[model samples]
Target: MEPGQLRVFAQYDRDLTLEADAVVVGSGPAGAVVAKELTDAGKSVVLVEEGPPFVPAEYEFDGGLSMARTMREGGLRTTSGTVMPTMQAVALGGGSLVNSAICNRAPAFILDRWCSDFELERTTRADLDPHYEAVAKFLGIAVTPENVLGRRNLLFRDGCDALGYHCEPMYRNVRGCRGSGECFTGCRSRAKQSMDISYIPAALRGGARVLTSVRIERVLAERWRATGVAGRVVTPFTGRPSHQVRIHAKLVVLAAGCTATPVLLQKSGNLANRSGQVGENLQFHPGVAIMGIFPELVNPRFGATQGYQSRHFLREGFKLETLWAPPAITAVRLPGSGMALKNRLADIPYSAIWDGIAVCNRSIGRVRVRRRSMDPILSWKLHPADVSVLAQALWVLSQIFFAAGARTIVPGVHGIAPELHSLEEAEVLRDRPIRATDLVLAGNHVFCTTRMHGDARLGVVDEMGRCHDFENLYIADTGIFPQCPAVNPMWTGMALAHRSAQQIAQQI
Candidate 1:
């Protein structure tokens, strides 16, 4: 059968029942990889997604409209304990559809720490190297071309060089990038190698079916073995349940995501939380942005969204990177009102934006399931040390801008001085008591909610992504990460999914 002939669950008018050798309850990088691998090995697979399949033409250039169409909770999902908004994509390809497209492999130090701290002996760098290579090749990963590195990225590089800090062009998973500076919104040119255009299509060609606009309500368990899943199709516009869906399979893979996967399990009466680790140990790479005003026209909105990142502070649990957003997003996040904001918007062409991402957050969070709607409720609080680190990172970012000859620096902090004109004023930011509410914080990467460990009491899954309580249930998302990987977790998450597929293939 042709790939386009695969069944879409939402098209059905009545209740449906399907059978597959494996059922994967997500369509992100991890779910896509798992579905593709299982089908390629001659197993019937069904990939379910809670979001719609967005064609390239349907993607919008406007940030607000794009977020409303693609992001979870219209990009307004926030934590309860802190003011940090969690930005996650809700589409067929998950965050890969809306991320910066940066693809960094798990750092060697992080892998070593996982092995030593979590006893993830099977997840060593050497063991996962081939999987990483395969994923990179499949995604067409390459360094952003220097010619396309717009003025904002160039300014960041200059600042890093002036400070003798180590910085390099980021490797991205794009094949024919046009430097549109719209990766966060969604790549309209089909240049971004997201899973929708990569693995999902391949899986379809291998006879795998995809069910979009459907939420997996629960995994059907039979005496500690996964039997399949039951869920309902949701209306694309209103996001309300419509048609009932039930799929029977020999195995079940939960790749929904860090936030949704645990919520699903909890709402299903904690099927996989025998060890009580279903929704614990959440770690997000909290980040803050700063804009530098340059004497020359920086034109931050005209190139790669994120082209370069500095590793100078990686050991300090933070990384500096250049970023860009459309005028609408940039205007709202500029930290001003009416006239002040208008003036800043007028100077958009001369401003360069960058972010210092705190990768080593000790602040643990949780994802609770709401009883009525089954939606996820996130709770997180920044550790005291994390607050200090964030302030230090902002200070460092200001210093970098000054070193790069910025005319003025607009720190994105809430109550801090609006603009720092000199090194002395920027230095004062280092001593200011920055509260959790004083900074504009956001995170896209979340992990460790259903972490993997050899010991059952320590984690919900094993090194191979198998749930400790169920023999045939598996998790193949960043939600199983032992801790924050201190880098973009896309490549690492895919590699882990590939490993999980291999293990499952062997078992079947």
Candidate 2:
């Protein structure tokens, strides 16, 4: 049965069943792109989201409250192994709604490695660049304009230039960005072209039906064929099941993210796991930051959330980027309790924060699918090798800060001095051994939970993102990456989704 047009929320209010040509779960970047692609090709699509659509005006601006509205478990989700906090978005646009809008293509070397090392065939820059180009055009991606590169970012650029390292403005999916620097709390300006403000609308225009506030339980599969899905309407705030939901479709696309997708399959039983590779090779670009305190005020709050970066150190296992967040979040990392901490918080206007994301392909982990929970238990450790890389990263950033004329740098690593006063002191971080448990790190880029391979024995999906065990089941998100892309994964994930959509369109 055809569902009513446009938006349908939990307000639909009863047992609702819909049938369409395709059903795409998760209304984030990949799902939104695929919904538009299939709908534009004249296939009716139903896009399901577990979270409600967000309005910019409703943004609470408080970190805890904002997480309550946007993230799973109010941002308390964490990894069990080396112990760094992580979060998954529970909103319609996924992480795009809270992310800084940085956009980067997968590096050519990483793609080449995927084919050479992970059995990915015909997957290279040559094959994927067109899709990347299309996504860039559709999102209005461009370099962050200098007019909004406030002191914090400009200082990063200055540091890079002084250190003779290559640095450039970040490419972001925003139009007329007013640089309110509130990207994490939700872009108040609505200038950030997150999917809800971009592709989801296009999908709607193309006659796709969007159903929000529904949590998918399992694929409606029998005899290894995806028939449809069965789920229930969930109240986004209360997390309570309200009504029954069933969707029948010709094709099923899973874009429910790395952790959630595998857990969904686990709940569905024997689907997508013939090779037993559904949630095995989890990887994330774990990153840590250093705060540089300068005598001059940097006024860190008035620019793009992340506007400058250096790729010069990518081969060294990390990428350096300038970062900004509300003082409430940053101040916690400052040392001392009492008046000493007071002085530190008061110095926020004079400080700038920079971070390095380790290219962590070797630090493989697994997502433990909880049988009765929406959230998965992640077990990942920072490899000893990655620990050294993290140390080297902090050391390098400290050098850049000193070169840029900062008075002091706060490394924020445990088991080390709280503050570094000179270049000589910073050397200890790199020259000596540091445990992975010491670094305060977080991950936004996650990959490889449902990696694609040409060999059926080795991977959960094929090169075209089709599950090895099912004909019409496709996975189109970062989860299909054979390795972490080692950069922002949004733009690259969407490009791959477009490729999958094209493949499906041709076959159907």
Candidate 2: tens digits of C-alpha lDDT, residues 1-508: 3433554463666898888889999988999999999988988899999988889887877778888789988888889877888888888888899999999998899899999987887789898999999999999999999999899999999989998999999999999899899999889899999999999988888888888888999899879789898898888777888788999988899999998899888888847998899889999999999999998988898999999999898887889999988668888789889988898888899999999998998899998777578789899988998888888899899999999989888999888888888889888777778888788899978899999998999899988889999989999989999998878889989999999999988765
Query: Which is the leading candidate under TM-score?
Result: 2
lDDT string for model 1 (1-508, tens) is 2332444544668877888889999899999999999988888888888888888788888888888889878888888898688877779999899888998888888888898998778788898999999888888899999888888898889998999989999999998888889898788878999888999999988888888888889888877888999999887746888789999999999999999899888877788898888999988999899888989887776788999998788788888899988678886777678888888778778998889888755898888887777568898889989988888889889988988989998887877788889889888789878898888888888999999998998999999999999889999999999999888899999999999999888777
lDDT of each: 0.87, 0.89
Query: What is candidate 1's TM-score against the reference?
Result: 0.97
Among all windows of 10 consecutive residues in model 2, the one with the lowest summed lDDT is 1-10
**Candidate 1 steric clashes:** 0
TM-score of each: 0.97, 0.98
lDDT for model 1, please: 0.87
Error of 1 at 462 (Å): 0.5
TM-score of model number 2: 0.98
Off by over 4 Å in 2: 1-4, 8-10
Candidate 1 regions with alpha-carbon error over 4 angstroms: 1-4, 7-10
